[model samples]
Target: MATTRKQHSEQSAPGPVAAFARFVGCGGGVGVASSFAVAGLASWIPWALANALVTAVSTLLATELHARFTFGAGRHATWRQHVQSAGSAAAAYAVTCLAMVVLQQLVATPGAVLEQVVYLSASALTGIARFAVLRLVVFARSRTQATAPAPAVRPVRAAAPAGPAELCPAA
Candidate 1:
């Protein structure tokens, strides 16, 4: 006897919203790694340029992971889709960075603690915004036949005789 594996359709796979959320989380991880790399390289290069380099590299890695795993295997996202998602993520990053700057200016905190707080806040905010925008726009699907539910199946039964075969047909 041979065993056969069931082929799962993309529609029947996990929810898009959930997959996107996971993708954002993975992106955050990549960003953290990039930050560490930048920190090490900042010693050799200009600080501002090092930060920018890390940001670009991390963003690319995150986007690739999102396209591959979050969207589903073998589904290649278009350039427009990438631009839309990246725009949303960039907006979120900008907002968070601005907020951190304002907070730092207002509080006059120590540099080390302030830096940690700022990055943490920005990562959280960016992750959330990425999830929302991706779910709403990037992966939004049409309500077409692709998503339609399968038709319900009902068992068939024979109809009974009208008068019991006319009382058994005289045997």
Candidate 2:
């Protein structure tokens, strides 16, 4: 059987916090699922490299998903948005890498679960930053003249004539 996606109106769009939560949930699912697949090979390659690879792939998928679902930019996805996504992904990866370093120092042999915990904590922290960048920078509403409202017209009042001198003379 075939399935369909729900249509969302711009005015009725989800709030920023709601959208961010959804985006993270969707993106986190992709990240965790793929990370599990990569975790199996920890012995073969360095844990950090494995985590980095997972982060790259997961981020690519997450950004695409966010563009479609969260920002409502499905067909209108722009190169600028994609670049911002890449930047967010890079930040997430860097944070995870740093966490990996700290984990490595703390334990001689970190298990997959332990590494996953660290990666997730770092990702959660970075997700807030990503949401800010994406909302305020990438998909921000433009203050273009076209969308701006026309200025209101005010009626000009005529100035009072020099009647003060005329009144004094009449008195």
Candidate 3:
């Protein structure tokens, strides 16, 4: 049987606040890992370049995490959703790269510490934006599930009691 949009919405996992919190947690973990990767690569590559590479990798990682943990995409994920996810990732990478470039110029030459600070700051902002896009656009199906009304429960009727005269006559 086909389910109504409202019924589907009620079945979606993770309330908005819960989803956002999960996204933040996942993004935070990705940020930490990305920052470390960037720091490790900074000595070998240009700071901005290192950040860009790490940010790109991290964004991809985040997409999967957000899909699974934040939005419950599971097997329902579609190519369209993948495209939206990629778009969000690109936006995040762009913001991170731009922030690193600006930070590098502001400071004569930033060390790993300063670069990490800037990178994390950029990641924080990108996380918020990514959450919005992933929820409202990438996972639009989930949003429907989130907002749909709960299914109406049918109450069961009780069986009628036997009359006292019928019970006595049966004996």
Candidate 4:
């Protein structure tokens, strides 16, 4: 049986709502893991290195979740695709962290509590940015496939007779 254009398009496209939900669920899991890691290991490692390590690991987990759930099982994304998507997210995360750092510096707080507050705010921003990028880019269908017009079908016409038919005389 032949597939209709609508069926093909629907099969190829991922739903935005489902993708967003998967992103949030995966991000929450990653966040919990990262927080645990940071809380347990921050004293042992430099802050920057610890953050980088946690982000890298969390990104891997998030990418796998995105591929499996957001993009669906049959659609396997290349490493480069994963990197490009995750890199955009990471860049956003870095910017958020930098902004928090700058803010903390300007505020000039004396206690460790201020530093913790900045970290939490930055973490939340990073997760939000990561989810947005994943939904908009990583799991989004290719533009060529998504927007391409379906092939047109023409109506079939009966073939003309090779010779003229004899006309019947009126009674």
lDDT of 2 by residue, 40-153 (tens): 656689776777777767766777677666765444446776777788888888887888889999999987789778877887788788888876777665212213456899
Per residue, candidate 1 scores C-alpha lDDT tens digits across 4-112 of: 2222233433476667566766776886786577668767996456666766666667766765556543245567667877787667556655765677688776465
Q: Give the runs in model 4 whose Cα sits over 4 Å from its true position.
A: 1-14, 73-76, 103-117, 142-171
Candidate 4: give the clashing pairs. none
Better of 1 and 3 by TM-score: 3
How many backbone clashes does every candidate have? 0, 0, 1, 0
User: lDDT of all predictions, in order shown?
Assistant: 0.63, 0.70, 0.76, 0.64
| TM-score of candidate 3 to 2 decimals | 0.70
RMSD of 1: 8.2
| Model 4's TM-score against the true structure | 0.63
Model 1 residue 75 lDDT score? 48
Question: lDDT score, residue 18, model 1?
Answer: 66
User: Model 2, 68: alpha-carbon shift in Å?
Assistant: 1.1
Q: Which numbered prediction scores highest in lDDT against the true structure?
A: 3
